[model samples]
Target: DAGITQSPRHKVTETGTPVTLRCHQTENHRYMYWYRQDPGHGLRLIHYSYGVKDTDKGEVSDGYSVSRSKTEDFLLTLESATSSQTSVYFCAIRSAGGESRNEQYFGPGTRLTVT
Candidate 1:
C-alpha cells in the first residue's frame, strides 16, 4: 500500500505563534505517526492515530496536538511555536500487523524554522 506524504516541505514560523502541518496517506492503513527529527536525537513521536477519531498522545506531545477525522488526513497543530520546535517533521504509515514491522516511510520532510 505504500502511500504517505507531508505538506509545506519547508516552513518559517514565528515564536509564540501557531502553525499547522498536514499529512496525507492513500494506503488506507490503520497506523500513522507524526515525528520531529533533530540532530543527535530519535524520531520523537508527536502523536499518532489508530483509526478515525481514535487518537493518542505520544512522548513529545507537548505544545503539539493532532487530529484525524478522516482516513487519509492527519493534521498537527502547534498551539504556540517556539524556537525549540524548529526541526524536520516526517509523516509515516505502517501496516496494521506488528509482524510486518515495516520501517517507517518518510516524506521529503518539512523543515520548520522558528524565530
Candidate 2:
C-alpha cells in the first residue's frame, strides 16, 4: 500500500533474457528498496535508492541493476534472466520522518518465473 505499485505483477520469461521491473511510490519517501523472496532465501536485498540518481547494490545484486530518476519512480533490471532468480520481488518505501521513520512499507510484489 502507501501509494506504492509494481508493474507486471506476474511475468514469465526465458532464461538469459533481460527483464525490468518497475516500482512507483507517491509517498515521496527518501529511501526505496528492491528485494526478492524465495522459498529458501526468505527475503534478500537486491538494490536500493536513497534519492534521485543515487542507488546502491545489495547482497544478491550480481545480475541485477536499479535506477531512480525521480522521487516517485524506481526501476529494477535483471540483466539476464535466470531460473535461480525466479521469485517474488518486493518494493519498499521508507516512511519520511514519522513514528515509523526508517520503517519500510512494502508493495504487493511482483512474481517472476524464468524458464
Candidate 3:
C-alpha cells in the first residue's frame, strides 16, 4: 500500500489569515512533497524536502512554506490565507529504498477554503 497521509481533510478560514496543514508517512522514505490540486491546472508543488530539515520551494511556491524535521512528518504553512490559495492540497512521497522510490503516492487530500 502507499505510505503517505495528510491532516485536516477539510478546513475553512478567512482571508488574510494564517493556516497550517500536516502530512505524515509511515514508510521511511527520503523524498516528500506538498502540492495543491486545483481545477483546470494539474497538481502543482508548493514545496518539497529531500531529507529531514532540508526543504525547498516548488512550482507554486508563493504565499506558502513547508518544513520537514523528521522522516515521517512534513508541515505546510500559509503566511496569509488568500482566496487564491483555496484548493485541495495533497501530500505525496517518493520512496527511497527497497524498490519503492520510483513511484509517487498521494495522501487522501486536504480541502482548504479561504473566504
Candidate 4:
C-alpha cells in the first residue's frame, strides 16, 4: 500500500470563496488522483496527475483544478466554493505495476463544508 495523507481534515467555508486542499504521498507513485464522495454519487474523479508538472482533468473537473509540481505532493483547488461542492475529498495513488497494478491506495478524506 502507498503512504498518503490529506491536509485540513475538516473545513467550513463561505460560498464563492476560494478553497485549496492538499494531498501528499510518501510512496513516490507516478499516478495520483482526486475524487469527491457525496451521497448517492459515490466517488467521482476530479483530476489526476501522471507525473511532475503533468496533469489531466477527470470526470468531475468543472470548477476544480489540480497541480503536481513534485512527485510527493498534489493539490486541488476550488476556484469558487459552492454548496454543491461540499463533500469528502479523497486522494489516491495507483500502483505503477505488479500484482496490484490496478489497485488504488487512498488517504484519509478531507471533509469540506460550503455555506
Candidate 5:
C-alpha cells in the first residue's frame, strides 16, 4: 500500500461543483504530490508539497488547489469541477533521503467523473 490512501476512491459529480480529495500517508514521507491521469495526457502534475504548509503549483494547476497541513496528509481541491477535470487522481510520496530517495510511491488512485 506504500502507506498511502486516497479518499472517495470513486466519485461522480456535476459540473461547477466543488470537490476535494484527500491523500493520507503513514510512511512519514517528506514530499507529497498530486497528479491527474487522462487518456491523452498521461499523468500531469497538479500540485506538490515539500513540507507541512509548504506547497507549490505544478504543470496543470489552473483549476486545482492543494494544501499540506501535516506531513501525512495532502489535500487536492477542485473549486469548480468541469468535464475536462474528470480523470484518475493519484497521490504520491517520496522520501527526502534514503536508498529509495528518488522513487515515488503512489496510492491506489481516485476516479473522479464530472458530468
Candidate 6:
C-alpha cells in the first residue's frame, strides 16, 4: 500500500468484455509498472511507464495496454477480457531519487476474474 493505490480491488467480468484497472501514487516516483500474477506463471510485466505519456510494452504485453498522464497515475487496460487473463494484477513503483532508487514497491493488487 504505502503511497500507491489500486482501484477496484476485486473485479468479476465475463469473457469478451473490456476491463480497466487504475494505479495512483502519492510518492511521485518516476517509474510505474503493471504486472500480473497467476498460479504458476509467477509475476509477468505487462507494461511500464518511465514518464508521462512514455510507456513501453513488456514480454506479456500482447493483450494489455498502459498509459500514464501524470506523475501520480498509471492506468492498465485489457482490450478483451479472457479466462487466460484472469489473475491478480499489481502496480509497482520505483523511486528515482533516494537510497532505494531502484527498489520497487508494489500496491495491494487487483483480483480480476473472468467467467
Whole-model lDDT per candidate? 0.87, 0.92, 0.91, 0.95, 0.94, 0.92
Q: Count the backbone clashes (under 3 Å) in each candidate.
A: 0, 0, 0, 0, 0, 0
RMSD of 4: 1.4
After TM-score superposition, the amount by which residue 22's alpha carbon in candidate 3 deviates from its true location, in angstroms, is 0.2
Ranking according to TM-score, highest score first = 4, 5, 2, 6, 3, 1
The number of the candidate with the highest TM-score is: 4
**TM-score for every candidate vs. truth?**
0.91, 0.94, 0.93, 0.95, 0.94, 0.93
By summed lDDT, the worst window of 10 consecutive residues in model 1 runs over 96-105
Residue by residue across 1-115, what tens digits does model 2's lDDT show?
Answer: 6999999899999999999999999978889999999886799999999899999988989989998999999999999999988999999998867665557899999999999
Q: Please give, for residues 1-115, the per-residue lDDT of candidate 1 as tens digits.
A: 3677789889998899999999999888778889999999978988998899888998899999999999999899999999999999998887755676655676667999999
lDDT of 6 at 59: 82
lDDT of candidate 4 at residue 72, scale 0 to 100: 97
Off by over 4 Å in 2: 98-100
Candidates in order: C-alpha RMSD to true structure: 1.7, 1.5, 1.9, 1.4, 1.5, 1.7
Best by lDDT, which number?
A: 4
TM-score (C-alpha) between model 1 and the true structure: 0.91
Higher-scoring candidate on TM-score, 1 or 4:
4
TM-score of candidate 5 against the unseen true structure:
0.94
Which stretches in model 5 have alpha-carbon errors above 4 Å? 98-100
Which parts of model 4 have CA positions greater than 4 angstroms off?
Answer: 98-100
For model 4, what is the alpha-carbon lDDT of residue 36? 98
Query: Against the hidden true structure, what lDDT does model 5 obtain?
Result: 0.94
